[model samples]
Target: MQRVLIRSIFKLSNQHATKPYLLQQHQQEARINSISCYYCVYSSKRGQQENDGWGKSKRHFISLLTLGIGLGGIGTAYILAKEVSALEKTATNNDTHENWHKERRTDLPTYKQEQITKHDTLEKRVWVTYGVGVYDITEFIPKHPGSDKIMLGAGSAIDPFWHIYQQHNNKEILTLLESYRIGNLDKADEVSTEDMGSPWGNEPKRHPLLKPASERPFNAEPPLSLLAENFLTPNEFFYVRNHLPVPVIDAEGYELDIEIEESDTTRSFTLEEIKKLPKVTVTAAVMCGGNRRSEMTEVKPVKGLSWSGGAVGNAKWSGAKLRDILLAMGVESDEKRHVIFEGCDLDPTSHPYGASIPLSKAMDERGDVILAYEMNGETINRDHGFPLRAIVPGTVGARNVKWLSRIIISDSESSSHWQQNDYKGFSPSTDWDTVDFTKSPAIQAMPVTSAICSPSQGEKVQIVNGCINVKGYAWSGGGRRIVRVDLTSDGGETWHVAELEQEDLPDGRHYGWSLWSAKLPVPSGCKQVEIWSKAVDSAYNTQPESFKYTWNLRGVLSNAYHRVKVEIE
Candidate 1:
């Protein structure tokens, strides 16, 4: 049997290269050539048997590898509400400029139909307005909360984007919009990505403690894979993680200034030159540094976004290797320990989001790190750091800075608070008053971690021999493999090892997450069974049971125990 193995779902940073293994062993004469096609072990389609150590986990990883078989009818139309034929009437009689406007007008205006949520996605158009200036909201309809019918107008407009919703737009619309806000509280453009701290996308919209990274924030999340369906979210989902406003980095005159103290040289790579490097594709995940931060709120009222695990995504990243370029520019190695990355945006909080890796991690043959230009096969969107972004695989989301303009190679780490005081794990008893930021290094590669992404609490499970099967993912930090995943039914008293899914990735790093499943046997005398599981990395690191022990005032790196309870047969 197979268990889906999921390592921490975010991306992993490292490097690896392998020769493709041949599927067929025999060679034939140029003309005699009639050999049957054979499946090759090294085919891009072949998955490794890395999870064999955990027999069950191996099965799951192998079976589910099929889940990501390949790309299909992508970039195709997914319009749901209503279909349109030709314009009710022909184009305007005006032959020039007016004709273009006619081509853009919709044949049908209002759509009031609802879509069936058969695939867990609304898959229909929905509409919302700031004032006027209509946009096709089809892409955002599924992510909204105004009820299914509200999505009908996704391709058109209902008015309210710029002008405040007065009598025309009331409380019901406001409430519905607020609920599906993906979390932020204000108008998406004006609040999260705005600049000037104005009522709309503006500069100076810095947080009470932050500095604007740019004049405008790119508020998008890149896709999780290279498959066609991820066109919108490709390698770059314009980043929107601003305590402030978006930045404005001009594509024409922008210069990437990199300082390498090793060779005592400073070099610059024009936006054009950097994009020309030999390209590489990486299927990696980038997660918010504050993902699932709300779980900590359960124990105490923390300050950051109470995000509940939706802040991360995966993508096929293509860019230049920072190390290769550094070496080419004569980056030196002496008294130095690590290399620090700085972003174009800076916040007053002393943390505009940054992280670092062992200089070795950067120079490793497997480190596929890069300064990305394209996301999901398209030009980087404005919301994501257009022009440039650092793709640090399998690392914290914050380190993958958007709108990047600076790169420094030195002996010290970054000075940003995110790379210093926050994003770390402290002792259980540590509190704001006594916690020492220096005591904990900024979090880099994460720890062996797992989460129940689906099957919410109170959800029913099938019973077999008084048992229920549990499924989830497990992952570890650095290059450490998840050696074992133990599931405890009834809290911490007793446990059983869950099965593991696939084990290796195309890049040859066993770093990708593995899905898992376990048939938990019901306790003989208990009314209910509480399920909890912990992952052990190759280095033997395991997650703690509660955030109380690991919690810091900043609420960084909360890899505590994850527990779920269900009724038993």
Candidate 2:
């Protein structure tokens, strides 16, 4: 088998040695076509020899060599074959090479660091390295959930970017990436994981009580039982939804940049300067757009962190009101413009997290937008955006950019990936391949949502006076107060109104969530009961009966009837 492999390499080299190194585009195309044809014939021949165990291995070896020739030339293919033979002879069972040498197959072609860099352009080809594997992701770029952000890893290692967006660090994504693998990276060119220090090394300590949805970017929410225990969620128990490592900033040296795009004027304000401005406190509930994504996944698999009912929290945020600051700066409000907020937390490419709200919302007296420095009457911690943060009351949490650094007034919306591609809703029938992000507007204010928190799913409950006590929280966005909460103990067959503890804010300015409790009647001789809750907002908007119709690719804005099953005692 070894002699045959060597002879094949020499024969291919001789055949291509006379060709003048494929400089023309037509010549490259012809070379690729010929190599592909050769691969098909070679594979068919190997398929016929099923009796020999070496046939399958030989086919993989030939496939890698042909891919190399198509990518570079015959000389590159020769080098790749030699590297594979060398690896097979000397590769050990160490942690570094275990995955690469799996299944006793070490015939994967190898490419140099510089060779991978040359294929960076989409026109040429898009290649990226993860560990020792090199993948051609050009075909997958358009289908990437994060949109063109995947291009940032072109001609480079995707390890760093995965460090920021840890959701991609899963088996399903790995399997998809493996289908695009064309070769392995040369061992000499491999960068050890230890050498690439962790981006999350500076992350702040978090409360142990918070249940994490992910650990690297550190997304977590409070336990549902503890969520509605108080009207104002405790700072330590407040849910955290981070997209990147928490940025470390010096509070004393912090500066917020304010940019006016029309005039191209920029101004900086120090922490002290911002503190000098009049401070206002607004009690608001910030909820993740995918708060109930886990439940949606039960109906159908969705793409996002699997948050339960605890991703929403109410707090008193204290900071300089955005309207007051804009007025003092002599900025003119235009409804057609947008107020963009950028966070200091950056991705692998140094792009800060950003989002935008309409200028009308920023300037509206009742909008209640603020550059918050305190939460729940205490100094904001690093996990919650320490030095400064944007508090866009009644808006999705994505728009409330934390680690607040810059504010831009522009005529257009933010160009951030989260703004343009993510955090948007789509039709239930719209799948990932057919979904057009631009067609759907970004989620701003959320709809009415309620959940049953106290009984805890699958817990055994004792019937007291033919009724079971229930407690949970209900909220709506855009200052649309939750007007009513209804509970059903028998699959919506009958309903009982829940008594709500609501804030005394005026109409259209009720930003905080409402805590509700009820005593639901249980049917006689029942072994189990399913509890459901739904809320009605000020505009009479109520949650959908089920997540089936509300399902989308990204699972944002999933406000369905919250349900939990319990065993009757």
Q: After aligning candidate 2 to the native by TM-score, how far in Å is the CA of 317 from where it should be?
A: 0.7
Q: Pick the candidate with the highest TM-score.
A: 2
RMSD, one per candidate, in order: 23.1, 13.7
Clashes of each: 80, 0
The reply for model 1, stretches above 4 Å from the true place, is: 1-240, 248-253, 262-264, 301-303, 334-337, 346-355, 375-384, 462-466, 502-508, 523-528, 567-569
Q: In candidate 1, where is summed lDDT lowest over 10 consecutive residues?
A: 64-73
Over 1-569, each residue of candidate 2 has an lDDT whose tens digit, in order, gives 11101010111122122222211223212222111111001111211111112222211221121111111101011101211233324332342332541222254567666667667677767787776777675654564445355565577665544434545545434433444566676665564434334556566788999999877678899899998799999999999988766766667667788988888887888878998999999999999998998999998777677889899999999999989888877787777999999876655444567899999999999999999999999999988888799999999998999987789999999988778877899988987557787899988998889988889999999999999999999999999988899999888889999999999998689999999999899899999999999999989999999899989877789899999999998
Model 2 TM-score relative to the real fold: 0.82
Candidate 1 per-residue lDDT, tens place, 1-569, comes to 12111111111111001101111112221101111111112212222221111121111100000000000000001111222222223322333431222122232232111111111223422233222111223333332212233333232223211111111123322322222211111121211112111212233222222221122221222221211122123332323464223444557666776776656677777788887877776555565655556677688644344455445554556677787787787654444467666554433111233456667667766766778887666666544566788877767766777767567776878765456544676665654435565777766676667665434465555578867777766666454566778888766777888777644654235545555667877677675667787887777889888866666544556567766766644
| Cα shift from native, residue 385, model 2 (Å) | 1.1
Candidate 2 C-alpha error for residue 128, in Å: 1.3
The lDDT values for all models are: 0.46, 0.72
